[model samples]
Target: MEDNHIHSISSKSACKVTDDICLPDTNWPRLVIVGGGFAGLALVEKLKNKKVQVVLFDKNNFHQFQPLLYQVATSALEPDSIVFPFRKQFNGYKNVVFRLAVVEEIQPTSNIVRTNKGDVHYDYLVLATGTTTNFFGMDTVADNSLGMKDIRDSLNIRHMMLQNLEQAAITCDDEERDTLTNFVIVGGGPAGVEMAGALAEFCKYILPKDYPEYPSTIMNIYLIEARGELLSSMSDKASSKTLKYLEDLNVNVLLNESVSNYDGSKVITNRDNIIMAKNLIWTAGVKGQFPKGIDKKYVVRGNRIKTNPFLMVEDYKNIFAIGDIAAVITEKTPKGHPQVAQTAIQQGKYLGTSILNIIKNKPIKPFEYHDKGSLATVGKRKAVADLGKFRFGGYFAWLLWSIVHLMSISGFRNRLMVGFNWAVSYFTYEKSNRLIIRNFNKPSESKSTINSQPAVKKITIND
Candidate 1:
């Protein structure tokens, strides 16, 4: 068969024409990772000073310590404390390059990735692209509510919260003021529960003294959820303990109900009840983030990439998936493992060693995740931790949670700064850096981002 004959055969076989997926200059092993979050960073760190060329891309230039982002938004921590520059993370490593670009898709057929900046190629591709907020296809919820995902999102929420208070101070109508004062946070997950607590703390210990004009009781922080209880992933004891803690702190906990709609000023629930509010915080749900080029059937529960226990997408060699995007399909985990930082970290470490072994023609070790535990803190002296069989709550739980999170930061400098912020916030009961700077897109940004892309051009990777 001639070259043209093979070309005709290939083109005829598929509906969409893919010319080729091979890299042009494939001299050295080039590894291009799609995310700068937990799993991607872990792989880069583990492979630092190794024998390969590494390139990392993300929309943001900083590696955020997400667990503490709620604190930043609620004025308990500074933005810089929770965010570490991505360049600084790999300063000593000579084999790594970082790019601030939005990944449009991975063209696995062409062995290229299409992005906003341009295309990129790799000998090996890693998909660590993390999850994003899931509104369950609700348009009003998507249109009116504010989400707590990245630093920018958190900052926006803070601005809206404080702005509402300032607005309420001048308004004469009690009903209107009450509407502005109600802060409704959707979801019972860690982010939602933690935000509700921090907001309550602000209302109780800080807001009263700061805003003498407004009554302290005027601040209504509601935590709404669709489940029967908060922290459904944790033990019964932890959930019950957390509920009591939130209630004690004046957090209005609503369970087994959901946000039906938000008309920019009031929240409509499934129970036909409406709560008037100026600010709505969405920490409700998340879905697995998969780039293009893979078969849609591979995307399973939570939109995760269907993968084997070895962390490889089924039937694909040289390409691997990790972090929140990759779902390790197993009988035990029919859907997938819980999407968490620890799970991503362990997978990255395992994959790092496995890749090295494969290079040396050694036996490959399959990746297995170990469930350490989970914790969510609700303001000062109120927290919960579940460590396998053991469970604890209250001040000690808060202490443990703080220590673990601080230590988990990639660099010591970040850990130190975060630790300092925590100490100051503990004593002062005030978040120092509360500047409302930029006005982010009000959930409508997604529409603009999706529309801005080119009409499916062949993306190339310039090595």
Candidate 2:
């Protein structure tokens, strides 16, 4: 880090101490978790009352269920459903303590983790920090586009979409209004597809009732996929069906078309064409959010940390990585498992049992991934499901998808709320909670602060 980039520093430091009372002698085999996402929460949940004392920490105080995050971003669901409070989840539980802290560094040699608040020693560490939305090494994409990783990002996207529609009404120029009304969702994967569908539905049902001045056709929703089809992970028939459903909903599904550039207004794709857009929802891909001090050699494709079949890091005993962060390399499975919540949950269960086995000097079992199949929703009465021998699309698929998701949700209250919301939306063709919150921020509006100039390298908190 360069000194020129350093700002607002204090020359002197203060040290405060209690009544010289010695710190509580921590129990042996202290497990420190860096994140509170899918994998980290699962790990602690499995070992809620185990021998090891668990200290789970995250920047935010909640565990965000990412699959439903797109719905939150598109204003289909409230924030409470997607985000589960970490403390509330572990309340009155023994051997588990949740801490809110920003993890700054991981000193693996010393078996310690540092944070903005303080440092803690760990007998074993689990790096389940999960993955961030991959912008494909494009700086402009990182800076200009809206990422759908966290709740704040989701709410910001929702606000931006609504604000653009409102702004479109007052604008006199038709060109400017069109630009504001148009929305481009990069990556035709499940997140992109869901968002595109929600936005398209908004245009059909919500917009007509609210913005009578703007017709449904005038508000265009474009889904850009670099691949030849959407939901490429699903069956070929499912992909075709999803495309058909999207096309019927009036979403422009642009397949095999890569976006070349986005200057916050015009999104130039491939060559010879450009789409005037306001919102650029980026859900392209994800790379592991590896914590510091892990050996660079262990980091493999997708920036994932390599692990053994036992879910332990290759060169280390005791230390383990799971969820989206760990890449288990095997002859049968090469590219690690898909970074899904279910895989993480299962891995956490296995790893917790494995830890118990290790303590008892018992043989550890290999972690095997169960294929429960994958399903995604495209709006009311529309979805696709792939279950190996069983593959389906359209209305029945949507019902199955809803039931599965509702049952899979973390808590009972959440499942009930989401169920109610879906039921109402299904019947009315309306998505409630479209109200915009917080200070105004838009995807099209350039934040000069983030793009001011070449940031003179600084040793910030992330460093």
Candidate 3:
């Protein structure tokens, strides 16, 4: 069959609706993907030269390498090195069309998707919207702490840390200086562990050179976890080794503790323990983020859309879900697959073939996820890996982590830039340019700091 005969719509006419997004005229089956994360991009790659007209919608014009977001947050790498433009990625793929728009609603009955920019109809819809920082309804913590989910969030952290360190040097009061230099990181996951380690290294190496007035010991690093162990998702051996590595780097690891509130300067834990610090990083949890319109019953825990084994949304044949936003509910896998890059990538590839097969009226198999192991780095020359039966940590694991991440980045230029930066940092222990280009103030500090640079709060710690 010819491409024009695949759909009922004519190939010569454009979208006629007044609020419709302008798209190329095509009679091929329209595969509209709502996100450009790992899953969406993988699916796009699979259908590159195919007859399907792939339309990708995302809020940002670029796809972020989320695994290396911590490096960006800690100044080990520049933001651009880890984020690739969507247009650049779709250079050779003629069938793919990239659109920068936030999907507002999904009208399944009308086969249309409403967005902030305009609406676009889809023959087959896929939701790969991914996850967002989950504050767990703690408004105070959400307002004060920064979550390392996006590139902008990473930059905000860098600016906040640099600005605070500079303020610490200018303050004459001893108590205020301590609060400014102290860092509190909530969560013991990979992001939290890596962030704590990076901050500790910054305090150990950069603090002395940048600000010689204060001792490096003045900058304290803390990693707090609600659970008793770090990397609870990984092996016990990996967890113990990660904790040890952080401690060796002078990071105060606080286990079985959870943050209750944060009023910008003080971090109050559920156990009534208070830590006076101006900087707080939250890496605790994430919930799926997607547009409204789906039935409430289809939504499950973690705010994910419940889907069948074929990666299709329940009771909907044309609509599908993938990546972190999808919860493939089955008897064997109750909650769904792990919300990671590997799972997303695999699902995208599988669904790509399945969708094409469905279009051809062929048999489609169930989506199966193969566990590809996991790796988490603590600091330079320190990492833990759980590769099936082979569980290891330290130098070799760190090397494997480095290679895997370097090769996983989107563009060749980005990979080269990151590899070069890593090599330089490895030899000299020096980070990228630490410049504060923007003024990022927490919600509590925003009003007071408006019209002023950084409102250096001089609050005395209560004993």
Which has the greatest TM-score?
3
Q: What C-alpha lDDT does candidate 1 achieve relative to the native structure?
A: 0.79
Candidate 2 lDDT tens digits, 215-258: 76788888899999999888888899889989998888888887
Candidate 2 colliding pairs: none
* TM-score between model 2 and native: 0.90
Please write out the lDDT profile of model 3 over residues 221-279, one tens digit for every residue.
Answer: 88999999999989999999999999899888889999877878877777767788999
Model 3: residue 88 alpha-carbon error in angstroms? 0.7
**Could you arrange the candidates by lDDT from highest to lowest?**
3, 2, 1
Where in model 1 is the C-alpha error above 4 Å?
1-27, 439-463
- TM-score per candidate, chains pooled: 0.88, 0.90, 0.94
Off by over 4 Å in 2: 1-26, 442-463
Per-residue error at 268 for model 2, in Å?
A: 0.5
* Model 2 whole-model lDDT (C-alpha atoms): 0.79
lDDT of 1 by residue, 308-417 (tens): 88888887776889998998888888778888899999988888887666555578877778999999998887799999888999899999998888889767777888
